[model samples]
Target: MPKKRQYQHLKSFKPIAPVSPALSSSSSRGSDSNAPAKGVNELLSGLRRSAAGSSSASSPHLLANGPSVHPDLRSILQIPDTPPPAPRRPVRTRFDASGRRLPAGPPPPRSWVTTRGQDVDLSHRMRGLKLKDAPSDHNALPGAYLPGRGSLIDRVLRAIASDWEFQRAYQQYHLYFLPNHLKPALLRHIGISGGGVTLADLKLILLPPTDLYEQGELEADSHTTNEVSYLDLSRSLGRSIRLRDVTNFLVPPAPQVHDTHLEDSWDAAVDATPSPPRALLPNLTHLSLALSPDDAEGGSWRHLLDFASKTSHITHLSLAYWPDPCLAPRAQTSKVTTPQGNKIYYGGTNFYSHSLDHDWSEALLVLRKLSRCFYELEYLDLTGCGSWFKALMLETEHDHVDWAVHWGKVTDLRLYAGFPRQEDMAAAEQVAFAEVMETAALVERHIRHMRAGKGRFINVERDRPAT
Candidate 1:
């Protein structure tokens, strides 16, 4: 009776081979009326005894390897010793001076020197008004409230504008085109040292004389600040804007031309460029200056003028010149003399020959001086530069037969031939064809490139790609 009780409990052990519900039910149904039915306890006990005998016989072999574990336990416990390491931090695109990572956005626009402890944004607290959207009030006082028009808003502006700290903040921020009377005050604040404006590019559009006359404010505080139209004060704003016969606009103080190792190829870097000009902007990266009427060779860019009688204005002047020093020394500095015997020096891969109404050679010459000191220039916009650009191409083709003015690292060039109410521009196909041949030199000089990426070109016309 004791042995029977012990075996009865053995029936509780799980089966070695599983009897599925389907098989169990089918077997039960078929066995009825055919054979004696086995009781659940008897079947389970029999299975348990058979499994025990088999396991005992195999026990020595199984123990030789290790105690045999249930298949379920094997899967649960066995894991790869070296699972793939936790995923690493993603790669970084850029870092700040401190070497910490910077999230992607337009970089803060200040040189290390100009960026102070606070690096405050001047316009952020300017009563939530955008300068561009501010309504024009001719009747209002220039920098403060007009004597009798003392509205609440005017009073507020007077208070803010009068605050010396606020004015300095505004100048530091490069605010532009305020009341005509306010310009001199701001310029005084900006002083000889440019308003801590650290812009990457300075684009100046020399509006035609016609545009200046219409502004009517041509003489607005012109005597005090020497600024032309409202836009000329953009020296306080961008890095760029329009110039309307403004002789002494508030440009940054002239800086000594720093030696540019402006290297593109290893060879150019080894051979440094010489006679760099005094740059107005030591920190500016790119500077674009354009004259409005490109075809106005008969205007300020007059090619027929007596070189001796008239001083050459730079805006209408174009000459082929190699900015890269490696090749500059090799170029024989060519000189052209005016009737007055004053030597007009134009050599070293620079050429210019376009008729103009006024001599723009002087104005454009300023850019040549600026280019030498411009560090890290990426884009050069010569659109509306017309003949001037042609002149540059001509000069480039002379020495560096394979390239056209690949200064430092200019990559994207925007060239457009446009004049308001002027004759329609050339057909797209025509411009495309010309551009293909013109840009060939750039393609060839790209120096072992599988694809042309030295610089990209954005042409005029609505459908043309801005690549």
Candidate 2:
């Protein structure tokens, strides 16, 4: 055991004040309390003043000669003749990192704190799948993305190693449909040194539906640079373009290019000149359009029709879920009263009456115009088109199309209507004999008219078998 240290003497010890020897000697002769203290104070003030006035390099004899401070007191009250210099901290040198001060070498291994004992880089592990501009396979389209690398055997081995690891590896690659930022780059790539892709030889183009795509921050700059137009497509097609799905892709280009200078005068001239009013797709053969009655009024459909005029050589046409053009009302009319005091005019199919023999005049008129537009049409598919097939078959008063005269080259036609059960049809016919009988008679006549031409194939499908 260690012994405790002693501090007992410190408790009773008395401190002594320094007094001048002369004053002390005089005080010893006749003891006076205040006089000795007053003398010592005077002497101390005189020494301090004299020491401050004298130079630092002066001899030590000046202080000895000046005040008769006793040797014992002098040692005790030893103030330095000159004040010491102010203390300074040492400066650490810093090298400029912007300009390399040291020889180039490999970067030091990342700290344990940074790596956290993980094999994969922290940033790489944290990163999510991002859409890439170019595909891993150069042969694939701009939007195509293949997740895994290597052959089937390699992939299978990887899958066997770890199911989660395989899934994570597969999730790294992503594809976005025709992003706004990528459009300009894709066009340049195709027009310039694009490998395996050529404008002249490019045949099929399948664009994603509007709902499936990511437009991605289409600001003024991006819009100007990346906006793909109908004109651009036409030029890129170069007479070989077919099977184009222009559902959401056909947009008119920006009128003016901002913040750019033209080096080539020919390019400037081309921009200045307006596009000629003619069929945009003169050689387009296979056309597919999915339009609703609401979109029929839009300028997009009109612009498309301008491209696909009578001059267009479209053969195969597919109208998926196309609206009934005849049922669409062109204009809204105000309520009107007849002279007989009965309200007659409002809008739409309400204008026609049951008393008057019903003729599908509006639908037939529209259909006739469309047939004339696509006069070279051979095959037509109207799948999921509501009441359009019925309208096509129904008789009209005027502007009737002779199936032989209009679609001379027609070989195949596919139509889809609801599957009305044979028993239900029979029951409906019995209940509404007059209406069903008339419709049945007209359907028989139209079927005969359509099938009159040899080598023509027409197949109408239902949701399910009517039997």
Candidate 3:
């Protein structure tokens, strides 16, 4: 059962009326103090409405149309008008895992490659620029082909001209016209079986007359024959041939005399014969001769001397005689006695010997004649000439032979032959051989002493090749 007590306190409570609002101290003390004061009920009711609107705006559906908050309260509450920026995602990339950039469009097609040894095989493929052929329907233009064709032609022509092997063969073995009669011998001598000869080889093996007028006159007077003549040489080997080297190739045999008296006087007459006044091969420079003393009845040397005397432009001269005392002395030299008038003898086994003094004097005469001819000689190689060359140098040292008239540009002089035969010399002959070699060594020393301070490339040596 429910108790109905506690009505005693409610019976005493009576209804009370609302009170008016009190004025502020500033307003009450103002000159408009008599103005009416607002009731507190109106202020209380306005505040109640604002509180109720705030609570309703908290709902998500009402937030879009919510009432504006007070300016002072909005700043305190830190309300944001704009929404937060959307979270940023990583930028998409076009690069692969290996860091190489992928293509923006479709991948290119693979290219087929061929190698020289493969003969146009298409097994290998790669990516590159493609070469396309021109259309066959287009008519060829002259100037259009000229640019590419001319450039290619120019490259080929330049390569052909600059090729060393081709140029050397052309310059060294270029063909020339030759006379039919003399062509066989000349070709055989030059080791060529061809009908013609080269300018380089012809100059060394043939001799042309010094004067063109004399050649022309000789040609007009003479009839065609089977012999080689100065006119034949001039006609075949032109003046364009430059005579640089005069070796043993062109040495002619001594003139033959059928008459007995002429044969008796031939030696003196040939030695006294003067050299030609006019020179041959004005640009002739090198003279290399290796001959025996008994060649062509001992008159072959005269031809070499005559050839040398005509040229004053010789810069390199090498004269070598066979059978020196240090070389094959026993075969060439003998102590056998012979008649005074009969100096040469065809003894047993084709052996001949004159007095050693006579042989020395003959070699001296050749050296003297050659010394008087050349002035521009730079290299003098007297190797294998025996001790006679040393005697000539000794004469020059003693003022008997002219030194300044012959030598000025001689920077290289080779005297002694580099051979091991000296070690095999008998003790009895070795003493004399050493003495003779020492005399030759003095010449090399004297040259070095004189040309010491001139700052030249002095290559004066006794034994060449460092023997």
Candidate 4:
């Protein structure tokens, strides 16, 4: 430093200061490193400020100004743009010989094809095969697959015929109320049995008149009245009519006089009707006539008995009568005092021996005639005939000629003992009378059996006397 170092053109330089050893070292190292760091920091701060300003601006404006564009390029870009033509495909010509332009042939059919991989020839297949043309076998044997002859019609016809025949046969043995339309069929097929047909199978028959005197739709005078009109429709029967059928015919006690008189007139009307032809029922085996005790005195019983006697072929007979003790004496005592009275008595008693004062002598004559006519008699039911039946039994003086001996073949007998009112001594007398009649019937049966050379077993049934 003593020797001045010639320095060329060191103009306006600041003077260097003296440094301590520590200070010198520090000045060289620290100041040199700090100078570069300070410059780098200032440069980095300026770059950070510029980057922050640009980031805060709107993105659209920034992008717009980001790239430069020439005016010529802008005008060229603004020109009306036209899109390029679409790619062209090859044109197919119809005149082409190979037919390439025609729509691709239909896709190959999807079918299961057996290939030659199997143990058979595929190329020459069906070469020698021919479909056979043969006639079908259509001729069939009788009653083959075709349905067998149907039996429906045949079965139905048979059923109808069988049912009709059964119905017809059943009607011949029982009385019935039948419809007017069907009566002809019933009559045409009346069975061999002599008795009347049953009430069943004649459901369609007309009901009897409720009021005999009233002129109603079902009156006897009605045009519709016929054979079916006689059926008693007020009752419904189960199987067969029994003894009750006879008893039920009696008129109830109410309006007794009116009903009794009307019934008497009805009986007369029935008797007045002309008899049917003899051949109407050639097999007629039985006949039954029922009368009330009150009607016996009015001379109705005599007429009924006479009618029964005239229709002679009744083999099995049943006569039911209700007795009136009050009138019995009058009938027994009445005699022909004058010519007119003689005629009346004769007509009433039918020319029977009337000298005997008995209630049933006149009626007994008619029964005797019936017995003589029906020689093959098998059964007799003289129920409710009163003391006359007793007298018939008691008058057994003539062994073979008596009434019982006349109908000696009668095996079945039903004697209904009629008892009159028995108040005080009357009841006892009535019982005595019934017992006498019962005894007579038993004795007659016994005598008939003894004559026939057959053992007689008598069965007696007795009940309290009924009016």
Which candidate has the top score in TM-score? Answer: 2
Q: What local distance difference test score does each model get?
A: 0.37, 0.44, 0.44, 0.41
Candidate 1 C-alpha lDDT tens digits along 183-229: 42233222112332222111111222333355656545333222322
Write down the TM-score of every candidate.
0.25, 0.35, 0.33, 0.32
Whose lDDT is greatest here?
Answer: 2
Worst 10 residues of 1 by lDDT: 313-322
How far residue 448's Cα lies from its native spot in candidate 2, in Å, is 3.5
Candidate scoring better on lDDT of 2 and 3:
2
**Regions of model 3 farther than 4 Å from truth:** 1-281, 292-299, 322-365, 396-399, 421-436, 448-458, 464-467
lDDT of 2 by residue, 91-120 (tens): 533444586464455444679535665646
The runs of at least 3 residues in candidate 2 whose Cα sits more than 4 Å from the true structure, single-residue gaps closed, are 1-282, 291-311, 327-348, 351-357, 418-445, 450-467
Between the candidate structures 1 and 3, which one is better when assessed by TM-score? 3
Q: Rank the candidates by lDDT, best first.
A: 2, 3, 4, 1
lDDT string, candidate 4, 1-467, tens digits: 49878777778678878778998898889888876555788889999988988885634445454555666786888843233344566664554477566446443344422343342564334322311111111111111121122245323322332355454455333223333433422322221111222333332222342433355644444434232211121111212233233222221112222233344464465433333333322344444433333343322343333444444555555454534212233454455567555424423332244335444443444445555666666555555654454544443223222433556565555554644344565666866676756665565665565555543332322233456
Regions more than 4 Å wrong, model 1: 1-288, 294-375, 388-408, 420-467
- Candidate 4 ranges beyond 4 A from true positions: 1-279, 292-306, 322-364, 396-405, 418-426, 449-467
